[model samples]
Target: MNKKGWWLMLLIAICGIQTVRAQGETPTDAKATPETLSLYKNLLKLQHEGMMFGHQDDLAYGIGWVYEEGRSDVKDACGDYPAVYGWELGHLELGDAYSLDSVHFDKIQGWIKTVYERGGVNTISWHLRNPLTGETSWDTSSKEVVRSILPGGEKHALFLTYLDRLADFLNQLKAEDGSFIPVLFRPFHEHTGSWFWWGKDLCTVDEYKALWRFIVDYLQKEKSIHHVLYTYSTDRFETEAEYFERYPGDDVVDILAFDLYDRGAGYSEALKYCASVVTAEAKKRSKIAAVSETGGPIAQNTEWWTKTVLPSLRPYDLSYVLVWRNPWQPASHGAFAPYKNSPDSEDFVRFYNDRKTLFQKEVSKLKLYE
Candidate 1:
């Protein structure tokens, strides 16, 4: 071959390697399905585009509404659905028909399938009960709870049964073509806070890491369920070191995320700082980053969406930011995203129109799983 031809082939080979590397790191599960891998790659690419918007329990129930077809608070407020949808599996461990939020497990299954079919992303968080006390996740009266669920502990065997129930539900998430739908499974989240049983004050660093690794191994290796992308998230932290204090190794986590709410006057500054930290760490590790959970009372601040939330998040390369759920009762103050004709609804529409944000109509064209 000529010298020029030989050099051309070498350049082509180098470009191919760089292209693959740009798709981001392989998921922690070595045996992850093809769709899951593609989803990860597309999510990484999305960071350069814009942050996708997400809502918790968007399709299940909204303020003054429940089980309504083709209805969503986000869509009603902004004229489009969010790019990502969040679901909870709190009571699945106890073989319950409904979640802790009173949404039926069967209804969740249907909603997940609908989101998948519409080319949207789905993320699941577990607020499981404390196995030792048989109380809610917030009942952190005992610090020994984490140790009891570890290997050789008194509740070790029973914990395995809980894992079995979780694996069963995950394994059944199939599309119309029988292909498994990829989900971002975020278990034991917000460990930096002492609110849950697995919080930092309730367990040693080693115990928390062990619990995370055990769940990943059990679901991927033992149960052969490989359609999930594991996400690790914290509540709030002032520094990168504080964020990773309880983080499991990269081998067991796919996305690096943090959860912060709009509490008071310093919310925007704090949110910006946390977003910068998470995006930098994710870039160094070649992983996806996001605000896994965020939002507060929109009624209090009429300009919260455009002035506070948008400016805080616009500077980062994060993949998505999800607001909490809007309850069914009108008197409830837990509503995060604005509902139809709410005080902040106009501001939310302006936020939606920003080029730096991507909603359902925009994200669907990305074909993330393909």
Candidate 2:
């Protein structure tokens, strides 16, 4: 049988009998039962095993990069996303390029707060820079710094400085109800890969674990910060074992997410890898799983995504999938050189619509806390 036939048969096998209710069962059914909602909440607390979530490093740059100037363009760019996902987690690259001054901090805090006020979730992460900024001199003890994006070494001392400031900022932003929902805090993500300064070269598994434990303890105990769900994410690595090995552990991790891109590569293999590594790990941990980032070169085919890629991932118990917009890329292909848009965006639109409908259908069977 062909792909469509195979999908249909699988659908029937899973939900055909399950969909029917006994006599006198009426329509207008709530998505899920309360018990199941509780179960989902408990399961989702694992963080790493939820749905695919969206990503916006582009927005981060646009906002944080020339933050000294009033970043209208940056604000405008991020404004585009609230219509689709209702939430976005921005990656703030805190290198020599941007200072952690009031201008930078206030701009980011304002942007995130603005989105949050508009009924969207906004969060941020920063990449730790290599060679430690401005110092091989490393502050041996926790000292107040405008921002701390240190690359490994004496991490406990360096990170405590950063976390102290972060916790202070977060506390200031708490809502009237004193709760911050969906604070997607991630540090040391994508460590399995070689690009980052602190990648495989920077530390051993034991060191990674110790660092994670220290951060979590400092954040929760000293700061009274309970609202954040820390994510353990990695770039799709050479093998699943490599991916699994970097996991910091359940005590320190609240979410499991992965970054994958087609990058002129085949979508089929990408999706298969996602299933094998991300999806399988999520199920094992009973954590939320997300496709944190994805998009392709502009010259690529969109049909594969719309018809094949999008449709292929829906059957999995996924939480969210976010498309990356690199300003360098558009929503669809055009004459611009090195354009970024999936080749088959139209198909993606159609596929997204259909999958959303299916999502609603499945969601209806879910139980809620109410």
Show model 2 residue runs off by greater than 4 Å: 1-104, 117-119, 131-156, 176-178, 328-345, 357-370
| Tens-digit lDDT track of model 1 for 1-370 | 6433443453354334333555347787778899898888778867866789999999999988999998999999988999999999999999999999899988998888999888899999999999999999999999999999999899999899999999999888999999999999999999999999999999999999999999998888899999999999999899889999888898888999999998887888899999999999998988999999998768878999888989888889999999999989654456899889999999998888887788888777657787
lDDT of 2 by residue, 89-200 (tens): 2212232223332125545555555444444434355543332443322222223121223234444365556567667666655444544433556666666665554455
Query: Best candidate per TM-score, number?
Result: 1
User: lDDT values of the candidates?
Assistant: 0.89, 0.46
> Residue 140 error for model 2, in Å?
21
TM-score of each: 0.93, 0.63
Q: Cα RMSDs of all predictions?
A: 6.8, 9.9
Candidate number of the best lDDT: 1
